[model samples]
Target: MSFLELSLTLHARQQERVELALEDLGALSITLRDADADTPDERAIFEPGVGELPLWNEIVLDALFDSAADRSGLVHALHELVPGLAPDRFTFREVEDRDWTRAWIDRFKPMSFGARLWIYPSTVAPGADDADKIIVHLDPGLAFGTGTHPTTALCLEWLDATDLEGRTVIDYGCGSGVLAVAALKLGALRVIGVDNDPQAIEASRVNAERNGVADRIDLHLPEDFPRRRENILVANILAGPLADLAPLFADCVEPGGLLALSGILQGQEGELLVRYAQWFDDLAVAVREDWVRISGRRRG
Candidate 1:
């Protein structure tokens, strides 16, 4: 079904208040984007952490409502609720429904993470020179971790460079199982992928099978996951959960095993370093754009 979408350009500071106002106004769904990003390559990432929203200086908030929503009344109410905003900032239109998943995947070009590893959408063709690189073919569908986002990119690069030979690994918050599968492809003896969502488990399974490493990987939900420790563990989730799961994560890695943590924003690493430092040593930081990855060896 088609829906009425109302887009508003405003200062970043007003986003939260406006988002609440939109929800109060009966918007079915809302999205925030960088208003000044006119280029196709620019993306909006909304990974929330402690007091973090990761937004540009100006934001374009889009609220979607049923086709029957009263446009004039809605605009009038927004003007009254959020005063001092220029009227020209408001734009409303009808948007046709689409298979969003297909649309997104169609645009996912082949990308290289580190020197030896590359990720290609099953729909796209890769370059001739990629014959020598370790390539991962992905049909991510509704699951996350395609190596496009910085969080997943950070993790994939770590997996690419690390020596996984004769080692077992754990991919916490496995998502599409990209990391678990990557670890296997990179010569890890075995990999255990853990995530809460059944869809994610299935996605990881499919990707692992596609890479011919299905037999070397195990997928599990958080509660069903075994208490066994491994030589390496990588988690690409938000900082809040990362901090809370530090103790569990430390236990998941054997003494002298390695740990890699992603999905953290730049300023938030200090808190994570302090939390993981309890059981981990020599925690090193890696930054890509606004994201950060923390790596260290569990204390022996």
Candidate 2:
């Protein structure tokens, strides 16, 4: 299916409000960008518990409009969400390639995390000799994750460095089930990946099989979250969701077990750390590019 692209520029402070409005209309994905494409000195978003999460003084919302109905739905939703805010300018055009997935493959490549891990997409791993590395086979097909992103890479590295042998692990917001699969590779006895998106869960299941560890990995939705605690838990979701899920993460990890989290802007780290401070001790962090990954043990 082809997608119609819609973009709008908004004041820095209004970006989140605009995103909420568009989300009410069901925007498949939204990304923030600078109008001038200027490289801001600060990070892009304020992430709690990471570095300083960027306040985003100015940004553009790039979203996909699947159809005319979708466009109308979004306009109506935005009007309702923000009583007076409307797009100052709007334009639409077909993305040329109906297969948006393939159009992006040229830019995607195998990424090495630190010096210990390398994530490989099935199509890109051919003739590679790093056979001993923790190789993850992800074919972005219909799913949303491949450990190439800084957030995912940070979390994967944490999992690799931690001692998971024979332990049970839970991957929260497990896009592509990459984290769970990585844990299994690191010797976790069993792992479960949970996400609200069914497509992500499906992709994760297939990827796990491709990695030859389907039997040890399970994928489900939030409604199906297991009742037991895991020895290690990891989540690479945004700061808001992470903060809201604190209690849940607290409940899911065994006492003294570690929880690694990412997908935060460098500035937001302090705020997020404060939220988790009560339940976790000695919150150590790992940094890659502009992203941050933090790990701490669940308090008993």
Candidate 3:
């Protein structure tokens, strides 16, 4: 498929009107990104909660239309709908669509964490040496956690280094079951995967099954969470929820168990360290790029 991509920048306040205008112009699809994303000071928006607009102060919208559409007509219509629309605001390019999944898989390749754990996409063939290394086969999908993001990479490194042999593990906020499946491959006896998104739970289950550890992991929504105290618990959710659920998380890990919290930005670790210190001892922090992972042992 081919498309004519029209890109322009607009203030967050004007997003709704611009989006409606693009739709009215028969745009096939629209993509919004932070216009100031190249600026180092711009904060990244990971995942927005339900009904929340994924917006920044300045947003760049790229509207796609049939390649044959009249470019001049689109420009005229947009300028008419938006008073004072600058001629410089509009940019055009022809784009060819390919299988996005295959494109992602090709770029992801094989990524290794810690001593012997590696994530491989289905397209790649592992070497004979992989017999000694723990392997996880994952495909790019709607759910998160493919070992690419700094946050997930930090958590995976923590999981890979930890001793999971014959222990029960909990993967709170398990996305795509990467950590849960990795823990199982690292020798964990059983894993409990919990996520609020039904799609995430399903993705986790499918990933677990794909790795031949489905029976060892149980996926659940928060409402039906078993809440069993486990030998190890790792949560790769944002810092806010990590702090809010501290007491609940504390209750989920038995005395003397292990824990790791991730999805925290660099400066945000201070509050989490203080809050988690109450129930966890020997707290330590690991940094990867701008992301932070805090690990500690449950106080006996």
Candidate 4:
């Protein structure tokens, strides 16, 4: 189904505010992109928020026009959602997705994580498999993660290299339950994927079953974080969220257990390390492309 594509020109600080405002108005998925493609470091991201409302429907267009007439409403809402943003600094426009959103996965391919592990959706898994490799099958859904992104890849690779045989692992922001599944594939005795989003929990469960590890990897809500400490904790969420979740990540891992994190920009490494330092000792950074994956062990 075609979706209404909305675009907004927002200042650095105003980005989240605008996105939240749009979300309140019915956006399902959003991407932040630079206004100018040639300028990669221009302090902007082309954010796309998708809604189920079809763009071809004139009724949806009419509502957009009506909403645009009172842009101040969104502007005011932004100021409330995010502080210190001058509403006038933001501009909004609406476009038709015209199938552009669905194409985001066009480039997706079977990804091999670690040295010998491969993950493929049942429909996408290559017909021929190397006898030596461990292959996992998964299907795409609306969940937040896929191993295709560097952030997810780093975490997957780490889980691959770690000796998880019979270890208990927790995936803090289990997107498609990919990392947890990976851990199970590596021989973790038990794994669980946790997320606040119900969709993520559902997707993770289904993906776990698809990979033949549903029984091994349990799904839980973020609030229902298991009381037992895990042998390993892996969180591949954004830098800010990871920092906020540092204490929880530390608490979840058993003493001497490792915590692996991704979804951080290169420059944010020092700050992240400092935040995690209070809880985790001997933090180390792993670089993949321009992204940094922070991994460390919890202090007793």
Candidate 5:
């Protein structure tokens, strides 16, 4: 069946009320986007820290409805739900249904990071030469980190270059367990994966099993995670949380252990270096596109 997509640009302040109204009016799904996306005025709406909610100042709210639904009725309802909503601002079009799963699978072909590391969907088979390569089998899921994002790629490349043989690794904020599995595949003795989101833990478990690293990686929620010194610690999370957990992260690494951090914008390196310098030495930064990765050694 086809669908009707109704969209309207609204101030960020009006999102909650308008979303509720759309749900009440039989919207099958509602999604928000930045109205200035792809423009010079585009903004970044990053993941908020615990108990914080951050959204774009101006948002494009899109609600999908059944094709037979009354468009005029939706507009009138929205007007009542949000006073002063402009009628001309409402836009909608019909969207045809297709195999979204296959489409996504088609787009996510095998991706390589560094020299020996590769990430591919389970549906795809590795090439003959890949017998010598370290492969990560991951299917897209609700959780993030498929090694496609620059932040995740940087961490994966660092793991590839590091000698993980017989080393204990900590993958803090382990989204989808990509880093944990990669470390294991690269010969780490043990790996611990921790994330605040339960879905992330589940995704990590599934990905680890897919990559046959489930036996080597232990996945847990942040509160349930055990603290310990490791030979290496990698966190592909935002710079803000990285700085906030500086002491805790420092404590997780053994003296002279390696620390690899990503999910930072280019200009944010200095602040992070200063934050981590208290416990780490030989700090260095690498850049990919607009993102930055910082690596260091735990001070002895």
Candidate 6:
């Protein structure tokens, strides 16, 4: 069946009301994207924490409806929902239905991190030359961390270079359990994956099982995670949260244990270093694109 897609560029403040109005008017689905995406003025907004709904200052809201539905009714409802919304800001188009899952999978191929680590969707098999590769089987889902982002790639590469043999690792803010699963497959005795989002926890579980390391990984929501010192701790969260959780992260690593942090923009490393210096030593930094990975050892 064909669908009618309506795209509206609106101020962030008006998003909720418009979305509700569209839903009331029988929108099948509503999705949002940053209107300034990929531009030099792009904003780096953190993923919302649980129970939080944050939007960009400028947003492109897309809503899908049955093609046979009343288009004029939708426009009228939107006008009433947002009194000052501009007519020129709305665009309507016909969308043909296709297998969206297959489309997404087609864009994701095997991606390599460093020399030894490889990430591939479950739909694809590794080549014969990948016999010695450390494979991480992941399928794109609601959670992030597919190793496509520079932040994730930096962490994955760092994991590849680290000697995880018999070490207990913790992946703070574990998304899709990619890093934690990689650690387990790389010989970590056990790994703990923690995230604030329940969806992320579930995604991590599924990815871990797919990688055949579910038995070696323990997934948890932040509040339910046990307080224990790990041999190595990695957090690929943004710089803001990394700084805020400095003490917590420090406490989770054993004295002299290693810590690796990513999701930091190039210019933001200094602030993080200063924050982490209170509990860690020998801090080093690695850069990929505008993102960086910082590693250090917990001091006694």
Each candidate: RMSD: 9.9, 8.4, 12.1, 9.2, 11.6, 11.6
Name the better of 3 and 6 by lDDT: 3
TM-score of 3: 0.71
lDDT of 4 by residue, 244-275 (tens): 87777777888899999987767878999999
TM-score, cand. 4 vs. native:
0.69
Q: Give lDDT tens digits, candidate 3, residues 1-300.
A: 676889887787766656555653445556677788777356353323323575688877877766766789678756644556668888999999745445445656788999999999999888887888889999766565687666788888988888889999999999778999999999999999998867678889999999999999998999999977989999987777899999989999999999999877678899999999999999999997566899999999
Assess every candidate by TM-score. 0.71, 0.71, 0.71, 0.69, 0.70, 0.70
The regions of model 5 sitting more than 4 angstroms off are 1-99
Best by lDDT: 3
* Pairs of residues clashing in candidate 1: none
lDDT for each residue of candidate 2 in 71-183, tens digit (9 for 90 to 100): 65456545544455555555555654355445344445787665456677666854656767777776544444466556777887787788888999989888667788878
Model 3 lDDT, residue 294, Cα = 97
Error of 5 at 285 (Å): 0.2
C-alpha positional error of residue 41 in candidate 3 after TM-score superposition, expressed in Å: 29
**Reference-based lDDT, each prediction:** 0.79, 0.70, 0.80, 0.67, 0.79, 0.79
Model 6 vs truth, CA RMSD: 11.6
Worst 10 residues of 3 by lDDT: 43-52
Once fitted onto the true fold, the runs of candidate 1 whose alpha carbons sit more than 4 angstroms away are 1-97, 126-128
Task: Give per-residue CA lDDT, model 5, range 227-248, as digits (tens).
Answer: 9888999998766788889999
Name the lDDT of candidate 4: 0.67
